[model samples]
Target: MLRRFGSKFLQNSLLLTLSGLYSTAALHAQQPAVNPAPIPLNPSQKAAAIAGNVQGKALIQQATALLKSGQLDSAIPILQRASVLRYVDPTSHFYLGLVYDQKGMSQMALENYTLAIKRANALGMDSAQLRINLGNTLCKLNFLKEAEFDYKRAIEIDDKNDVAHLNLGRVLLFKGDNQGAFRELSRASALMATDPNLPLYQALALKGMGNNEECKNQLQIFLDRAAGTHSDPRVISMAQNLLAELK
Candidate 1:
């Protein structure tokens, strides 16, 4: 994953208790008790919830496979069906967010991600992945302060989460906190050295600090990594041109 301004959705799925885009089996298995007990579900309501979970799980599985195949049109309805189930976990809402995000439905994505976070928190599962994803969506919607809070919260839960560090660096950079950006990105680099785009952000942080030599070195590192590993060609080309200018 790119360190700055990149979606952590895919990475977050793998890293968290939520395993994939649409698997809520783990959450369903737990059935965590709600903290402030509201009117408890009646027997009929309980039966419906159980039935909803079974149907929802099957729908989610199908939706996940469809999403992986780039079948967003097909996945959306399945995900929508899954989202209404009482037993559906944050993962379902999260994938719904992703599907909406992919379909250019920013408002819908934000709504579902928000719901996912709320549901996750209510379940007493402070998943770092959920926070990072919510942060990413918040950033996309220009909710920078909210994004920063989520990223910071993610770090608090899992201090070593590189995705949180990477995202926090970008948020700090945008806020003109270059030193803070450098610190977070450096920590991310320590955790994820093989990522090709990190040095580019580091270079930008150095440039903001007026440390031109270090900036150039970071740009060179980006170029080397880009050449040897996977990276967006547009980003790599930009780095190459910037490196020459720095030289």
Candidate 2:
């Protein structure tokens, strides 16, 4: 059964580097156990499955190309097919989760990310990035408690993970834990100062604590950097909208 877990093209090609949301890493396929238990497959069944695995790999490559070109709709079906293959590994499922995420299919994203994490753990691979990915999906679903747990667990695995700090801060803000949000956002900003979202979140935390002036200051800082260097239209718009709502 494990013979289908081929070493060829074991490296996942997709790199999920979405800032403030999903973290990234290519999934490495570990070799199966030596002399793995044999499961009886009829000749026809074996042939068909091997062919399916090849098709799965091709679909994964196609999906990766589509994702890189920002053709999310085209990538989704290919990734979905790849995930169902008998030899499909964590990487395929992880990419499927990412594609679903990009398409704003939060429920589907959560499901696939969960599957990816499970497969990663089963394969004895590191799952820190998958945890962050799943945590982001949980946040999108407003599952703050679960999201916090995932982020904290990821932080425990790697203390220097700035994305975990940033996301944890956002979740805390949503939970109305202003002080906690402030502390985590501060840590995240200290780790990556150029992140425009950090100050924007910190400002929200300050606003929740009734520090209107401080909040305004933070928003201004966010706006200045976001518009000048970082310059994400969404970030700039969010900061400007918040600033307008404040004064």
Candidate 3:
């Protein structure tokens, strides 16, 4: 049964929540709530806002297409123009952060992600995915505490966010909070039962808590599930080494 489940998981692994990138559905999920008492705008002001919004949408669409085609450099200017628009969508800054992150520019990614959050707030929008992306950049910059905070906030926004829970588990592990890491990992595992990586993380947390037997069991489960899949070779190697050490 486990093998069958593992094979099914491997086949659908592309849909895993680990990646911090937002899909079109996720973008829509982050849409701002309707304001019951929106501030009235004058006719000219509303007309100008509509024009800016239309232009910004076009730029964002163009940038998204470039990003999809792996033309990260070309996407940058278009997204930058969108970011400066009068009614800019926060998604522009979010995409800019993703491009910078993919380019290995952690500081630039962090800056854009910060701007994204600020813009999102201004637009009366809150997004778990945005927080997750920002947390990922923070992790890359070695800002573990900041990343933890972001992950926690993401969870608060959407408690069912398995990515946030998984990331929070990782951060807790790094901070040597073994029990806390285990608790978060358990929650993530419950939320995403098919994720093979969860067992590895759970094993690490168990090992940290000196539960050698349980850790070994989790390592074996990880190895079994990861076999014949596209799991990271480095991670598999580490799991093998850890399992051997436990033995």
Highest lDDT against the true fold, candidate: 3
The sequence of per-residue lDDT tens digits that candidate 2 reaches over residues 44-148 is 988887787788879988888877777888887787887777443766778877777777788998998888777666655546577788888887777879989
For the record, the alpha-carbon RMSD of candidate 3 to the native fold, in angstroms, is: 8.0
Give lDDT for model 3: 0.75
Q: Using Cα atoms with residue i matched to residue i, what is each candidate's TM-score against the true structure?
A: 0.77, 0.69, 0.81
lDDT tens digits, residues 1-247, model 3?
6644543343223123233222112222343332222447899987877787779889988988787788989999998988877344577888888888788788998998898788778767778888988888887766889999999999999999888898888778767788999999999988984556888778777876878799889989989999999887766775776666556
C-alpha lDDT values of all predictions: 0.70, 0.69, 0.75
Candidate structures ordered by TM-score, highest first: 3, 1, 2
In candidate 1, which residue pairs clash? none
Output the TM-score of candidate 3: 0.81
Best by TM-score: 3
After superposition, the stretches of candidate 1 with alpha carbons farther than 4 Å from their true spots are: 1-39, 228-234
List the candidates ranked by lDDT, beginning with the highest: 3, 1, 2
